[model samples]
Target: MTTTTPPTHLPPPYAPTDSDSDPDSTFRHIITSMLNSHHHKFGFLIYRVNYDNDALWQNYLNIIDQQTREYVVLEKKEHLLPHIAWTPMEDREKFEGATKDEIREFFRDWIHERSEDRDGPGAGVDNTELIRWSPRYKACMYVNGEMMQGAKMQTVDFLPGGPQLHVQGKGVVVDGQYDEHDRDVLRRSAVGAREDFEEVEGRRGWDVGWMYFTLRGVHMVYETLCMSEEEWTSP
Candidate 1:
């Protein structure tokens, strides 16, 4: 819940744009811009921290009375969670016939319990806080062309004197091939690799460098990445 300020020398924060008008768009923009490499001298590795949706959904049912439907979800704007839907569970029997508003209320309450308003023992961990607080997505930067062998590894701190932004403060490239944000580059990868992109905790190196970003720093990086290729590397 705490945040560190970004270094002042970096470019100004990025202004909100219609380009990120929705959650899906916002998520995509964050993932895309951070993964883009302005120069071959810079390389990026990212790992997405996906929600344990299935397990969390099952936890929600513990509060429901009696047997409920196999699936009970409410449609949300988040594209990553499309399989979920909303429906009345056995708890509806209380009202004899749950009204539309009642069903919505029940669903809303379930959502709230997962994040806030439910504490103490057996309240369950807040999945929302887990998604928000835990580095949902980790990004690593390989500087000085370290991505290619035979090149000496070097570190680059985009925001210096702010927060430590290197993986263990040593220039090390994360092992394994990463899913590139560039569509063309991604398409060139083997179909199987593309189909089953690995999910990782970033304990290795993906969670290093720009892993944790402040609000201001995020905006700065987003704006910097969105800049023209020429502008990106300019002094």
Candidate 2:
């Protein structure tokens, strides 16, 4: 490879726009772009799991098995009447091998279906219930650590208004009119994580982490890295 000397003249600097100075606009654009891009890539929400145990290995195996199996199949034959035909009960499919676009459509349809299940067995179910039905979809980690008897450290917790004491991992507090829709979405995402953990790992002696949103959804996990308030009403 050839190396060249730099010229004395420099290029013009980037000029800041009105949106660049406005936190709301900047955050909105950045978050919207990220969400849409992720949605487009995975077609569904995909969590980033961090682990250092054998359980995670088992979870991976389960997911792989699901993806390679039949997309949907009937559980058992059911006949309503003596001359009636058997009805098929469709089972939900896994996310393995699914294109990003296909997953997006799947999530949209899943939300729509749950929202309209007003009078069925799924009545009163939240829109995010289906997505949280499996433990693999949750963002979480399994690790080992130790605390000394005289050790003292700063504590952190996530609340409805935002993270208490600190915003995400940044030691700064963001005081603003946080969107209500976004707050509710974040809250529900947190609830789903707890529900999944309780149902799946509670009996196995697993304990809740110190962090409130320890097992949050993938989007919430991303929120820790960026301070964007994109409305999730459309999501």
Candidate 3:
């Protein structure tokens, strides 16, 4: 065996900032910085099934299993995600194995489609009726936690699926104004959100956790199966 002696000099230690000193804040800082963009900034509106007792969770997921219903993609935009929920029904039914990007695109396009539905051919259709056909957990995403301002359009209790709220479990918002076109997008989105959750919405359950972290397809049936088993467990 061979051994060597080290040089007499040593390197400097890392100087920590107040933010870095707080481990929780440091983790949060990393996530927020990564999410501060349009493309990489993500959405996270999801049901959190947090419960200790196994039996209660089982009861809850029995309801979740029944929650899958189907809807058509009227604008030819539907793929893995649509409107507020990530599970878009393929042919008014579901298929397995969609990519995360496909679902994110679904969310992005749905935002765009809301504008089209307003002035485009979809105007002939009653927009409110469209919303009435969605799931109990209506959701949306904005740049930060702040909502875009506009003419008052009705909203159901839609949860936000933006990136910041779930990980370290807190978020901060910087508010801004929305012009007419922007406002139209925001308002119409609310109506669609209401339709999804209005009838089915229940007071978010007690045993449920805050959110289900997944690889892709925020609410897609195929993707959700991969969630922590407790999420779909019912008593």
Candidate 4:
């Protein structure tokens, strides 16, 4: 099918803190440029974990999976994901490595597939076999605010070039340790529209900015929303 170019002109790339030789920086700009807006801007990244170079794991089934259990997860550091006992999935194997282009094409096809109708394929898409959590890669989504009690969430103030250091916030130590290098790599594209708490107090405009990160080594993402907040919040 022939597709016409979108009449809407996307904004120029958002700046990154480490653009000189960072693929993540470039990828962040490319994806965020798609969701440009005058009133509000948003960027979401679904990436494999990096920086935590030595955390071990063994279980990946959804029930025992942190992806499912994390919400009910308590503040106990031992109960946190890395220290949990390892178990295997019954029906499917672990998630495999998905490259930047393969994931990009998946979205492209999904877009064209849905453009014909808004109901969105009318059935569940099977990504369970495709993506799984592994020891090497820890899949993480870019959540705008504080997640865990001590997650080193990157803070991007809407400045001209982005923050020199990731906005420093105190986070918890899991299993008696905290990996200060917390950045999510773009295994897939970006997502969502939750209103991030602005750096300016009581002056919340829409969350508009970009964040750069890198890929992890293990398996992750049996099912992910990329945390689609706009769909959840749209009135």
Q: Against the true structure, whose TM-score is highest?
A: 2
Evaluate all candidate structures by whole-model CA lDDT and list the values in order: 0.25, 0.26, 0.24, 0.23
The C-alpha TM-scores of every prediction are: 0.17, 0.20, 0.19, 0.19
lDDT of 1 by residue, 1-235 (tens): 1101111112222333444446543243332332342110111221111122434223322212111111111112232222111121232133223332333343334334432222221123433222122111112222211111221212345665443222221222221212225432434453423433334433222221122222113223333434332212111
- Which residue segments of model 2 deviate by more than 4 Å? 1-94, 115-235
lDDT (tens digit, per residue) of candidate 4 on 1-235: 1111211222333333333234432223222222221111121112221212212211112222332233213212122232222222111111224333333333334323322122111112332211121110112222112221223323356757554223222211011011112111111123432344354323333321122222110111211211231211111
Give the residue spans of candidate 3 off by over 4 A: 1-125, 135-137, 141-210, 217-235
Backbone clashes counted, model 3: 19
Candidate 2 lDDT at 57 equals 34
What candidate 4 gets wrong by more than 4 Å, as runs, is 1-46, 52-64, 67-140, 143-204, 209-235
lDDT of 3 by residue, 28-139 (tens): 3222221221111112222211223434323332222222211112212222121222211221121123232233343334443442223232212334422222211122
Clashes per candidate (backbone, < 3 Å)? 3, 4, 19, 19
- Return the lDDT, model 1, position 64: 20
For each candidate, C-alpha RMSD in Å?
A: 21.6, 24.7, 25.0, 21.3
